[model samples]
Target: MLNVVALMGRLVADPELRHTPQGLSVTTFTIAVDRSYARPGEQRQADFIDIVCWRGTADFVCKYFQKGSMIAIDGSIQTRTYQDKNGNNRKAFEIVANNVHFAGAKNANGNTGGGYANAQPEYTREAPPAAAPSFAIGNNDDFSVIDDEGEDLPF
Candidate 1:
Protein backbone atom coordinates (compact mmCIF):
# COMPACT_ATOMS: atom_id res chain seq x y z
CA MET A 1 0.00 0.00 0.00
CA LEU A 2 1.13 3.56 -0.76
CA ASN A 3 1.26 6.00 2.13
CA VAL A 4 3.42 8.75 0.70
CA VAL A 5 2.57 12.40 1.04
CA ALA A 6 4.26 15.61 -0.20
CA LEU A 7 3.62 19.20 0.77
CA MET A 8 5.11 22.63 0.09
CA GLY A 9 4.37 25.37 2.57
CA ARG A 10 5.74 28.01 4.94
CA LEU A 11 6.71 27.15 8.47
CA VAL A 12 4.27 28.44 11.07
CA ALA A 13 6.94 28.48 13.78
CA ASP A 14 10.58 27.66 14.39
CA PRO A 15 11.35 23.97 14.61
CA GLU A 16 11.89 22.74 18.14
CA LEU A 17 14.71 20.22 18.36
CA ARG A 18 15.15 17.85 21.24
CA HIS A 19 16.52 14.48 22.14
CA THR A 20 14.58 11.31 22.74
CA PRO A 21 15.16 9.22 25.86
CA GLN A 22 17.61 7.10 23.84
CA GLY A 23 19.52 10.29 22.96
CA LEU A 24 18.27 10.36 19.38
CA SER A 25 17.63 13.75 17.80
CA VAL A 26 14.05 14.78 17.08
CA THR A 27 12.32 17.94 15.89
CA THR A 28 8.74 19.13 15.51
CA PHE A 29 7.19 22.04 13.65
CA THR A 30 4.09 23.22 11.86
CA ILE A 31 3.63 24.21 8.24
CA ALA A 32 1.01 26.57 6.92
CA VAL A 33 -0.19 25.50 3.49
CA ASP A 34 -2.58 27.63 1.51
CA ARG A 35 -5.58 26.21 -0.25
CA SER A 36 -5.34 25.71 -3.99
CA TYR A 37 -8.48 27.69 -4.71
CA ALA A 38 -10.02 30.76 -3.13
CA ARG A 39 -13.70 31.59 -2.93
CA PRO A 40 -14.91 34.81 -4.48
CA GLY A 41 -14.71 37.82 -2.14
CA GLU A 42 -13.08 35.63 0.49
CA GLN A 43 -9.51 35.44 1.70
CA ARG A 44 -7.41 32.40 0.89
CA GLN A 45 -7.42 29.77 3.58
CA ALA A 46 -4.46 27.90 5.00
CA ASP A 47 -4.08 24.52 6.67
CA PHE A 48 -1.64 24.13 9.54
CA ILE A 49 0.09 20.76 9.44
CA ASP A 50 2.27 19.26 12.14
CA ILE A 51 5.53 17.64 11.05
CA VAL A 52 8.14 15.54 12.83
CA CYS A 53 11.69 14.76 11.78
CA TRP A 54 14.28 12.47 13.28
CA ARG A 55 18.08 12.10 13.52
CA GLY A 56 20.17 14.23 11.16
CA THR A 57 17.07 15.58 9.44
CA ALA A 58 15.87 17.07 12.71
CA ASP A 59 19.20 18.75 13.43
CA PHE A 60 19.39 20.24 9.95
CA VAL A 61 15.88 21.65 10.13
CA CYS A 62 16.31 23.34 13.50
CA LYS A 63 19.68 24.84 12.51
CA TYR A 64 18.66 26.36 9.18
CA PHE A 65 14.93 26.97 9.07
CA GLN A 66 12.83 29.51 10.96
CA LYS A 67 9.25 30.60 11.22
CA GLY A 68 7.75 31.70 7.86
CA SER A 69 10.51 29.98 5.92
CA MET A 70 9.07 28.19 2.93
CA ILE A 71 9.78 24.48 2.90
CA ALA A 72 8.84 21.28 1.14
CA ILE A 73 8.40 18.04 2.97
CA ASP A 74 8.05 14.45 1.77
CA GLY A 75 6.77 11.97 4.28
CA SER A 76 3.99 9.70 5.49
CA ILE A 77 0.87 10.55 7.43
CA GLN A 78 0.58 9.33 11.03
CA THR A 79 -2.18 9.42 13.62
CA ARG A 80 -2.16 8.77 17.35
CA THR A 81 -4.44 9.07 20.34
CA TYR A 82 -3.76 10.20 23.87
CA GLN A 83 -5.52 11.52 26.95
CA ASP A 84 -5.72 15.30 27.40
CA LYS A 85 -5.06 17.04 30.72
CA ASN A 86 -8.79 17.36 31.41
CA GLY A 87 -9.23 13.57 31.13
CA ASN A 88 -10.61 13.77 27.61
CA ASN A 89 -9.27 11.61 24.79
CA ARG A 90 -7.38 13.42 22.07
CA LYS A 91 -6.38 12.41 18.57
CA ALA A 92 -3.52 13.93 16.61
CA PHE A 93 -2.40 13.63 13.02
CA GLU A 94 1.10 14.51 11.86
CA ILE A 95 3.54 13.92 9.08
CA VAL A 96 6.63 11.83 9.67
CA ALA A 97 9.01 13.73 7.44
CA ASN A 98 11.69 11.72 5.69
CA ASN A 99 13.02 14.65 3.69
CA VAL A 100 12.77 18.39 3.99
CA HIS A 101 13.88 21.08 1.52
CA PHE A 102 13.83 24.83 1.49
CA ALA A 103 11.08 26.11 -0.82
CA GLY A 104 11.13 29.93 -0.99
CA ALA A 105 12.01 33.31 0.52
CA LYS A 106 10.99 34.29 4.02
CA ASN A 107 9.13 37.44 4.89
CA ALA A 108 11.04 40.40 6.32
CA ASN A 109 9.71 39.82 9.79
CA GLY A 110 10.40 36.11 9.62
CA ASN A 111 14.05 36.46 10.49
CA THR A 112 14.67 35.09 13.95
CA GLY A 113 18.11 35.45 15.57
CA GLY A 114 19.78 34.91 12.20
CA GLY A 115 21.31 38.12 10.86
CA TYR A 116 21.00 37.44 7.12
CA ALA A 117 18.18 38.95 5.12
CA ASN A 118 15.58 36.84 3.31
CA ALA A 119 16.96 37.88 -0.10
CA GLN A 120 20.31 36.36 0.79
CA PRO A 121 21.11 32.94 -0.59
CA GLU A 122 20.20 30.33 2.00
CA TYR A 123 23.17 28.03 1.32
CA THR A 124 26.02 30.48 0.96
CA ARG A 125 27.49 32.70 3.65
CA GLU A 126 29.05 35.12 1.18
CA ALA A 127 28.62 36.19 -2.43
CA PRO A 128 31.15 34.58 -4.82
CA PRO A 129 33.71 36.95 -6.29
CA ALA A 130 33.65 37.55 -10.08
CA ALA A 131 37.05 37.24 -11.72
CA ALA A 132 38.50 36.50 -15.18
CA PRO A 133 40.31 33.19 -15.61
CA SER A 134 44.11 33.55 -15.45
CA PHE A 135 44.58 31.31 -18.55
CA ALA A 136 41.96 33.05 -20.69
CA ILE A 137 43.08 34.40 -24.11
CA GLY A 138 41.71 37.91 -24.74
CA ASN A 139 40.91 37.48 -28.44
CA ASN A 140 40.35 34.85 -31.19
CA ASP A 141 43.69 35.93 -32.73
CA ASP A 142 45.38 34.22 -29.78
CA PHE A 143 44.22 30.82 -31.11
CA SER A 144 45.50 31.42 -34.70
CA VAL A 145 48.44 29.06 -33.99
CA ILE A 146 46.07 26.04 -33.84
CA ASP A 147 45.99 23.54 -36.75
CA ASP A 148 43.02 21.54 -38.12
CA GLU A 149 45.06 18.28 -38.37
CA GLY A 150 43.95 17.36 -34.77
CA GLU A 151 47.64 17.32 -33.82
CA ASP A 152 48.91 18.81 -30.57
CA LEU A 153 47.92 22.50 -30.31
CA PRO A 154 50.19 25.00 -28.58
CA PHE A 155 48.70 27.13 -25.83
Candidate 2:
Protein backbone atom coordinates (compact mmCIF):
# COMPACT_ATOMS: atom_id res chain seq x y z
CA MET A 1 0.00 0.00 0.00
CA LEU A 2 1.28 3.42 -0.91
CA ASN A 3 -0.12 6.80 0.08
CA VAL A 4 1.87 9.91 -0.74
CA VAL A 5 1.30 13.50 -1.82
CA ALA A 6 3.48 16.42 -2.87
CA LEU A 7 2.06 19.93 -3.11
CA MET A 8 3.32 23.45 -3.79
CA GLY A 9 1.12 26.46 -3.20
CA ARG A 10 0.77 29.82 -1.55
CA LEU A 11 -0.24 30.02 2.04
CA VAL A 12 -3.74 31.36 2.60
CA ALA A 13 -2.89 32.63 6.04
CA ASP A 14 -0.25 32.52 8.74
CA PRO A 15 0.21 29.16 10.39
CA GLU A 16 -0.91 29.06 13.99
CA LEU A 17 1.04 26.55 16.02
CA ARG A 18 -0.70 24.60 18.72
CA HIS A 19 0.17 21.90 21.17
CA THR A 20 -1.54 18.70 22.13
CA PRO A 21 -2.43 17.95 25.71
CA GLN A 22 0.75 15.92 25.93
CA GLY A 23 2.84 18.93 24.80
CA LEU A 24 3.35 17.82 21.24
CA SER A 25 3.45 20.60 18.66
CA VAL A 26 1.00 20.77 15.81
CA THR A 27 -0.23 23.22 13.18
CA THR A 28 -2.91 23.31 10.53
CA PHE A 29 -3.10 25.64 7.58
CA THR A 30 -4.52 26.00 4.09
CA ILE A 31 -2.88 26.72 0.77
CA ALA A 32 -4.27 27.87 -2.58
CA VAL A 33 -3.15 25.66 -5.44
CA ASP A 34 -3.81 26.80 -8.98
CA ARG A 35 -5.27 24.37 -11.44
CA SER A 36 -3.02 23.18 -14.23
CA TYR A 37 -5.44 24.19 -16.99
CA ALA A 38 -8.30 26.62 -17.52
CA ARG A 39 -11.18 26.68 -19.94
CA PRO A 40 -10.71 28.79 -23.02
CA GLY A 41 -11.35 32.46 -22.24
CA GLU A 42 -11.97 31.64 -18.59
CA GLN A 43 -9.83 32.38 -15.55
CA ARG A 44 -7.75 29.62 -14.02
CA GLN A 45 -9.14 28.01 -10.88
CA ALA A 46 -7.50 27.12 -7.59
CA ASP A 47 -8.19 24.68 -4.80
CA PHE A 48 -7.76 25.39 -1.12
CA ILE A 49 -6.00 22.43 0.46
CA ASP A 50 -5.71 21.83 4.17
CA ILE A 51 -2.44 20.55 5.64
CA VAL A 52 -1.40 19.44 9.08
CA CYS A 53 2.13 19.22 10.50
CA TRP A 54 3.46 17.66 13.63
CA ARG A 55 6.34 18.17 16.09
CA GLY A 56 9.41 19.90 14.63
CA THR A 57 7.82 20.25 11.24
CA ALA A 58 4.87 22.12 12.78
CA ASP A 59 7.18 24.49 14.59
CA PHE A 60 9.18 25.12 11.42
CA VAL A 61 6.07 26.09 9.48
CA CYS A 62 4.79 28.45 12.16
CA LYS A 63 8.14 30.15 12.57
CA TYR A 64 9.16 30.56 8.93
CA PHE A 65 6.00 30.59 6.87
CA GLN A 66 3.32 33.28 6.77
CA LYS A 67 0.41 34.51 4.71
CA GLY A 68 1.09 34.43 0.96
CA SER A 69 4.38 32.55 1.28
CA MET A 70 5.04 29.80 -1.23
CA ILE A 71 5.28 26.49 0.60
CA ALA A 72 6.10 22.95 -0.43
CA ILE A 73 4.75 20.00 1.46
CA ASP A 74 5.41 16.28 1.25
CA GLY A 75 2.97 14.09 3.05
CA SER A 76 0.17 11.60 2.89
CA ILE A 77 -3.59 12.00 2.55
CA GLN A 78 -5.64 11.62 5.70
CA THR A 79 -9.37 11.62 6.31
CA ARG A 80 -11.52 11.80 9.40
CA THR A 81 -15.20 12.13 10.23
CA TYR A 82 -16.47 14.44 12.90
CA GLN A 83 -19.69 16.06 14.12
CA ASP A 84 -20.13 19.75 13.43
CA LYS A 85 -21.52 22.31 15.84
CA ASN A 86 -24.85 22.12 14.05
CA GLY A 87 -25.07 18.37 14.85
CA ASN A 88 -24.25 17.26 11.32
CA ASN A 89 -21.57 14.72 10.52
CA ARG A 90 -18.90 15.72 8.08
CA LYS A 91 -15.82 14.18 6.50
CA ALA A 92 -12.59 16.13 6.16
CA PHE A 93 -9.56 15.32 4.03
CA GLU A 94 -6.11 16.78 4.60
CA ILE A 95 -2.44 16.10 4.21
CA VAL A 96 -0.46 14.92 7.19
CA ALA A 97 2.82 16.63 6.44
CA ASN A 98 5.98 14.62 6.81
CA ASN A 99 8.10 17.53 5.63
CA VAL A 100 7.58 21.20 4.80
CA HIS A 101 9.91 23.49 2.89
CA PHE A 102 10.37 26.90 1.34
CA ALA A 103 9.19 26.91 -2.24
CA GLY A 104 10.15 30.34 -3.61
CA ALA A 105 12.89 32.89 -3.87
CA LYS A 106 13.97 35.23 -1.14
CA ASN A 107 12.06 38.38 -0.27
CA ALA A 108 13.25 41.99 -0.73
CA ASN A 109 15.13 41.87 2.58
CA GLY A 110 17.29 39.04 1.22
CA ASN A 111 16.29 36.74 3.98
CA THR A 112 15.35 33.16 3.24
CA GLY A 113 15.09 32.28 6.90
CA GLY A 114 17.26 29.89 8.84
CA GLY A 115 16.67 26.43 7.46
CA TYR A 116 15.29 23.63 9.58
CA ALA A 117 16.67 20.12 9.89
CA ASN A 118 14.80 18.72 6.89
CA ALA A 119 15.10 21.77 4.64
CA GLN A 120 16.69 21.22 1.25
CA PRO A 121 20.07 22.66 0.41
CA GLU A 122 20.24 26.13 -1.17
CA TYR A 123 20.68 26.24 -4.93
CA THR A 124 24.30 26.75 -5.94
CA ARG A 125 26.35 26.21 -9.05
CA GLU A 126 29.51 24.13 -8.88
CA ALA A 127 32.45 24.53 -11.24
CA PRO A 128 32.97 21.83 -13.87
CA PRO A 129 35.68 19.16 -13.44
CA ALA A 130 39.22 20.36 -14.16
CA ALA A 131 40.08 17.60 -16.68
CA ALA A 132 37.01 17.69 -18.92
CA PRO A 133 36.63 14.59 -21.13
CA SER A 134 36.68 15.38 -24.84
CA PHE A 135 34.07 13.81 -27.11
CA ALA A 136 34.10 13.13 -30.90
CA ILE A 137 31.49 15.60 -32.17
CA GLY A 138 31.91 15.21 -35.98
CA ASN A 139 32.08 11.41 -36.16
CA ASN A 140 29.32 10.63 -38.70
CA ASP A 141 30.68 7.19 -39.61
CA ASP A 142 29.15 5.74 -36.40
CA PHE A 143 25.65 6.53 -37.60
CA SER A 144 23.47 5.11 -40.41
CA VAL A 145 21.12 7.26 -42.46
CA ILE A 146 17.55 5.99 -42.90
CA ASP A 147 16.28 6.31 -46.51
CA ASP A 148 12.63 5.48 -45.78
CA GLU A 149 10.26 8.39 -46.34
CA GLY A 150 7.89 7.26 -43.55
CA GLU A 151 6.00 4.73 -45.78
CA ASP A 152 7.77 1.71 -44.22
CA LEU A 153 8.23 3.21 -40.76
CA PRO A 154 6.66 1.53 -37.73
CA PHE A 155 4.72 3.92 -35.59
Candidate 3:
Protein backbone atom coordinates (compact mmCIF):
# COMPACT_ATOMS: atom_id res chain seq x y z
CA MET A 1 0.00 0.00 0.00
CA LEU A 2 1.09 3.52 -0.71
CA ASN A 3 -0.09 6.94 0.34
CA VAL A 4 1.71 9.97 -0.95
CA VAL A 5 0.76 13.48 -2.04
CA ALA A 6 2.54 16.53 -3.40
CA LEU A 7 1.37 20.11 -3.78
CA MET A 8 2.73 23.44 -5.02
CA GLY A 9 0.67 26.47 -4.21
CA ARG A 10 0.45 29.76 -2.36
CA LEU A 11 -0.34 29.99 1.31
CA VAL A 12 -3.79 31.29 2.16
CA ALA A 13 -2.57 32.64 5.49
CA ASP A 14 0.56 32.79 7.61
CA PRO A 15 1.49 29.58 9.39
CA GLU A 16 0.70 29.45 13.07
CA LEU A 17 3.50 27.85 15.09
CA ARG A 18 3.14 26.57 18.61
CA HIS A 19 4.89 24.28 21.05
CA THR A 20 3.45 21.21 22.65
CA PRO A 21 3.87 19.98 26.23
CA GLN A 22 7.20 18.34 25.37
CA GLY A 23 8.39 21.57 23.70
CA LEU A 24 7.95 20.18 20.21
CA SER A 25 7.31 22.81 17.54
CA VAL A 26 4.27 22.44 15.34
CA THR A 27 2.85 24.65 12.59
CA THR A 28 -0.35 24.67 10.59
CA PHE A 29 -1.33 26.61 7.49
CA THR A 30 -3.67 26.52 4.52
CA ILE A 31 -2.62 26.45 0.87
CA ALA A 32 -4.70 27.88 -1.96
CA VAL A 33 -4.32 25.67 -5.00
CA ASP A 34 -6.00 26.91 -8.14
CA ARG A 35 -8.01 24.45 -10.13
CA SER A 36 -6.62 23.34 -13.45
CA TYR A 37 -9.83 23.97 -15.34
CA ALA A 38 -12.40 26.70 -15.37
CA ARG A 39 -15.73 27.22 -17.09
CA PRO A 40 -16.17 29.59 -20.02
CA GLY A 41 -17.86 32.30 -18.00
CA GLU A 42 -16.95 31.38 -14.46
CA GLN A 43 -13.95 32.49 -12.47
CA ARG A 44 -11.21 30.05 -11.60
CA GLN A 45 -11.68 28.14 -8.38
CA ALA A 46 -9.18 27.32 -5.66
CA ASP A 47 -8.97 24.51 -3.17
CA PHE A 48 -7.95 25.31 0.37
CA ILE A 49 -5.71 22.57 1.70
CA ASP A 50 -4.60 22.33 5.30
CA ILE A 51 -1.00 21.42 6.02
CA VAL A 52 0.98 20.59 9.14
CA CYS A 53 4.71 20.51 9.83
CA TRP A 54 6.69 19.48 12.89
CA ARG A 55 9.95 20.24 14.72
CA GLY A 56 12.68 21.89 12.66
CA THR A 57 10.55 22.02 9.54
CA ALA A 58 7.82 23.84 11.43
CA ASP A 59 10.28 26.31 12.87
CA PHE A 60 11.80 27.01 9.48
CA VAL A 61 8.42 27.55 7.88
CA CYS A 62 7.28 29.85 10.64
CA LYS A 63 10.43 31.91 10.44
CA TYR A 64 10.83 32.16 6.66
CA PHE A 65 7.41 31.72 5.04
CA GLN A 66 4.36 33.93 5.17
CA LYS A 67 0.88 34.37 3.77
CA GLY A 68 0.69 34.24 -0.07
CA SER A 69 4.19 32.76 -0.32
CA MET A 70 4.42 30.01 -2.92
CA ILE A 71 5.71 26.71 -1.61
CA ALA A 72 6.07 23.07 -2.53
CA ILE A 73 5.03 20.38 -0.08
CA ASP A 74 5.88 16.69 -0.09
CA GLY A 75 3.75 14.70 2.28
CA SER A 76 0.88 12.31 2.85
CA ILE A 77 -2.82 12.89 3.35
CA GLN A 78 -3.98 12.31 6.92
CA THR A 79 -7.43 12.17 8.48
CA ARG A 80 -8.32 12.28 12.14
CA THR A 81 -11.46 12.51 14.23
CA TYR A 82 -11.96 15.03 16.98
CA GLN A 83 -14.84 16.48 19.02
CA ASP A 84 -15.88 20.08 18.60
CA LYS A 85 -16.94 22.46 21.34
CA ASN A 86 -20.53 21.39 20.88
CA GLY A 87 -19.54 17.73 21.41
CA ASN A 88 -19.99 16.89 17.75
CA ASN A 89 -17.47 14.45 16.30
CA ARG A 90 -15.71 15.95 13.31
CA LYS A 91 -13.46 14.34 10.76
CA ALA A 92 -10.59 16.50 9.52
CA PHE A 93 -8.20 15.96 6.65
CA GLU A 94 -4.81 17.56 6.20
CA ILE A 95 -1.40 17.05 4.71
CA VAL A 96 1.38 15.92 7.04
CA ALA A 97 4.33 17.70 5.43
CA ASN A 98 7.61 15.82 5.50
CA ASN A 99 9.38 18.39 3.40
CA VAL A 100 8.68 21.96 2.35
CA HIS A 101 10.47 24.22 -0.10
CA PHE A 102 10.10 27.81 -1.22
CA ALA A 103 8.81 27.76 -4.78
CA GLY A 104 8.98 31.50 -5.47
CA ALA A 105 11.40 34.42 -5.33
CA LYS A 106 12.82 35.55 -2.01
CA ASN A 107 12.80 39.00 -0.45
CA ALA A 108 15.87 41.11 0.37
CA ASN A 109 16.21 39.20 3.65
CA GLY A 110 16.20 35.92 1.68
CA ASN A 111 12.76 35.02 2.97
CA THR A 112 9.43 34.89 1.17
CA GLY A 113 7.80 38.19 2.03
CA GLY A 114 4.33 37.03 0.98
CA GLY A 115 2.55 40.26 -0.08
CA TYR A 116 4.94 42.69 1.56
CA ALA A 117 6.69 43.33 -1.78
CA ASN A 118 6.34 42.77 -5.47
CA ALA A 119 7.46 39.33 -6.63
CA GLN A 120 10.63 39.54 -8.68
CA PRO A 121 13.60 37.32 -9.37
CA GLU A 122 16.73 38.52 -7.61
CA TYR A 123 19.65 38.47 -10.06
CA THR A 124 23.37 38.40 -9.48
CA ARG A 125 26.15 38.64 -12.08
CA GLU A 126 28.25 35.51 -12.76
CA ALA A 127 32.03 35.32 -12.42
CA PRO A 128 34.39 35.27 -15.42
CA PRO A 129 34.49 32.03 -17.46
CA ALA A 130 37.20 29.48 -16.63
CA ALA A 131 39.78 28.02 -19.02
CA ALA A 132 38.78 25.27 -21.45
CA PRO A 133 39.06 21.62 -20.43
CA SER A 134 42.05 19.40 -21.44
CA PHE A 135 40.99 16.12 -23.09
CA ALA A 136 42.79 12.74 -22.85
CA ILE A 137 41.38 10.19 -25.31
CA GLY A 138 43.13 6.96 -24.39
CA ASN A 139 45.76 5.13 -22.27
CA ASN A 140 49.55 5.24 -22.90
CA ASP A 141 49.67 1.81 -24.63
CA ASP A 142 46.95 2.76 -27.20
CA PHE A 143 46.77 6.51 -27.67
CA SER A 144 44.15 8.37 -29.71
CA VAL A 145 44.09 11.92 -31.10
CA ILE A 146 41.07 14.24 -30.76
CA ASP A 147 40.32 17.79 -31.96
CA ASP A 148 37.87 20.41 -30.83
CA GLU A 149 34.51 20.08 -32.62
CA GLY A 150 33.72 23.75 -31.95
CA GLU A 151 30.42 24.91 -30.36
CA ASP A 152 28.08 23.32 -32.98
CA LEU A 153 27.70 19.91 -31.28
CA PRO A 154 24.27 19.15 -29.85
CA PHE A 155 24.11 18.66 -26.10
Per-model TM-score on C-alpha atoms: 0.68, 0.72, 0.70
Candidate 3 wrong stretches, greater than 4 Å: 106-155
- Candidate 2 clashing pairs, residues 3+ apart or interchain: none
User: Stretches of candidate 2 above 4 Å error?
Assistant: 113-155
Which candidate number would show the highest lDDT if scored against the true structure?
A: 2
lDDT score at residue 18, model 3, on the 0-100 scale: 100
**How much is the lDDT of residue 81 in candidate 1?**
99
Q: Give candidate 2's error at residue 25 in angstroms.
A: 0.3
Q: How far off is residue 112 in model 3, in Å? A: 4.2
> Can you rank all candidates by lDDT, best first?
2, 3, 1
Give the Å error, residue 1, model 1. Answer: 1.2
Score candidate 3 by TM-score against the native. Answer: 0.70
Candidate 1 positional error at 76, Å: 0.2
Candidate 1, residues 28-93, lDDT tens digits: the string is 999999999999999999999999999999988888888877888999999999999999999999
lDDT of 1 at 82: 98
| Ranked candidates (TM-score, high to low) | 2, 3, 1
Q: lDDT values of the candidates?
A: 0.85, 0.88, 0.86
Worst 10 residues of 1 by lDDT: 111-120
Instruction: Say which candidate scores most in TM-score.
Output: 2
Backbone clashes in model 1, listed as residue pairs: none
